[model samples]
Target: MRIASLRQGAAVISEAGAHLLPMPVGDLVTLGLDRALEVGATALASEPVPYAEEDLLLPYRPASVRDFVTFESHVEGVRRSVDNASGVPAAWYDAPTFYFTNPHALYGPGAPIPRPASSRALDFELEVGVVLGAGGTSLTEREAGAAIFGYTIVNDWSARDLQSREMQVGLGPAKGKDFATSLGPWIVTADELPSLDLDCRVSVNGSLVGQDRLSHMNWTFAQMIAYASRDSVVVAGDLLASGTTGGGGCLAELWGRSGQQTPPPLEPGDVVTMEVEGIGSLTASVAVG
Candidate 1:
């Protein structure tokens, strides 16, 4: 069963039909499959359901969100792009790593993305995100699949210069990224996007910026979850984005800003569209004052 957030509330989509449900994004997340069925039946209406698309929203409302950088090529490209001292540390290869962000970033599709007034070099990372189904610790790789609920498109908006300046301390982006990030029109269940292989792309306005397949992640979801569960707990509705892909990913990758001859900074009014093959596209229109 697939669940989606719409303007009216929440809705369940299945072979039988669609029904309006009143469950919050967190509840279905924590409750898992049982809750999904319960809410579906309980919220089923006696009348026929409508099938309009405008009212739909992304299926993310996690208690928290953590996006990881799982592509080695992305790391290498970014290093050269931003003039970093060297490649990612060897520890980064030992296991998966992640950074948290706001789960409230359920910006509706077509929502205009803000151009941070503090930034001159803004970029977007096109990624595939996984939604955890329940709380778990020391989760095994085999068991990790059961903990998944679905997948969605994630755009990790970035301010390149700010990210570079802060990383030397070994922390990160802070205000460099506190601006805005975006996710989803719907969360396609694990069963829905069964195959991990899918084509992904990042386009600026009508021009292509980055395009790659989802198969390139240095660390897979199962591995990340397993590694994460060893020390900390992953709960239902916790989202993990699989980071950016190869070339055409972020501006930091495409144009080596501080290292090579710099390209003209991205002007305000630029629109970025990122899409995954099975899921959907996330479109952001950038603007600055």
Candidate 2:
């Protein structure tokens, strides 16, 4: 079942429409996946209301956010552009790599994303995100996979110019990325998504610019979770993102391919729409901060 956090409250979405839940969506996460599914099924008996996209909110305020770079093509593309490297580093192939991002910077569907004041090159990353329904430390892949509660579209909005400068210091994509990130429409529970292979696409101002399949990832969400949980505690409501896809996931890849900024960076008022099959679309408008 699809669960959404609406302005009114938590909701269970069905083919007919959205049904209000007696509790907030965050409460459902605390209940764990099995119990949450049970509660969601019961909530579906309530009167259905139109699923107004604008009424949505972040499915829940994440306890923390970890974004993993699992797409080799994306890594290769950006590395060539930024470092002029021949290919991915050997260490990258050994394990899933990620960075902790600001959990407080989240926005929901239809929200306006502010372009960082210091940034001149703002870009959108098309990705798939999962919410954990159970907590564990040093989890195995199987255990980690079972911890997944649901999936959603993620836009890891980037200030490319600022990111480049910060990475030169040997740490951080901090201020470069901490400004904004988008998640929502809603979350489709793990049971509903038995397969991870899905088509992912992004469009800007109504023009289709990039597309990739979720199957292209070099690492699975399970691996990402396991890697993240190693000697660390990961709890319910934590957000994990499968980083930018290849085959045009972001403009940096485009620049890498062409060796110049072909399409200019995002400008105020530019609308970005990212969609992942089975989950849904998440669109955000760029605004001057």
Candidate 3:
């Protein structure tokens, strides 16, 4: 069943729509989405309330957010664009690489994303995100796969110029990315979304600018999760992103090929929509702060 965090409490989404329920006593921060999903129908204390996608918030705040770069094509393209001699390194193939992102700053569907005042190069990274169900440490691939509760679309909104500058210092994507990360529409329980062969696409203002398949990721979610859980606990509500797909996943990759002047970075008021088959779509407008 699809679970969503409602204004009043937690909700179980149906084919017809959302059925609101009060969260059991205790803060969701402590209880986590894993326990909520385990409670299942028992959490619904009332009849279904009036609900719409826009009225909902992020399915839940993640306990922690780890985004992985699992796509070789994306890495190759990015490396080739900047330093042609360097390709996907041997270390990258040895293990999946990832970075921790700000979990405090998040947005749900339809939320207006404020343009970072420091960025002239704004872009979007289309990705699939996994939300863990149960808590575990040093989990094997099988154990990690079982811990998964659901999946959602992740719009890892990026400030390209800021990211490039910060990486040069070898310490961060910190302020460059801390502003916002958009999630939701809703979570699709893992059982329901068994296939990884989904089509991924992104459109800006009415044009299809980025399109690819989720199957392009060289490292599977299982490997990424296992690596993340090594000697460390990954509790319920922890988020793990599958990183960007190749074939024009973001403006940095696109602009690198087409030139910054041709397609231009995202401007205020531009509407960006990203979709992954089966999970649903997330759309937001760019607004200047």
- Write one digit per residue (lDDT tens) for candidate 3, span 1-289: 6677766557777765566655521233245445655655564444666776667777778879998988877777655443332467888888888899999889988888987898887888898998876768889999888777778999998887777777777775777788889998777778788888999999999899889999888877888899998978788778899998888887767655654534678999999999889888889889855
Residue 95 of model 3, lDDT score: 85
Better of 1 and 2 by lDDT: 2
Off by over 4 Å in 2: 83-86
**By lDDT, highest first, what's the ranking?**
2, 3, 1
Estimate, for each residue in 1-289, the C-alpha lDDT of model 1 and write its tens digit. Answer: 4667777667775545456676666577677755665665676543436655566666656767788989887877787766454677798798887887766545656667777777777777888888888768899988787788788788888888788788777775576676776877667767767788899888877788778888888877998888777878888888888988886677776665346524344677878888888787777677655
C-alpha lDDT score of every prediction, in listed order: 0.74, 0.88, 0.78
- RMSDs, each prediction? 3.0, 1.2, 2.7
Error of 2 at 142 (Å): 1.1
Instruction: Tell me which of candidates 1 and 2 scores higher on TM-score.
Output: 2
Distance from true location, Cα of 144 in model 3, Å: 0.7
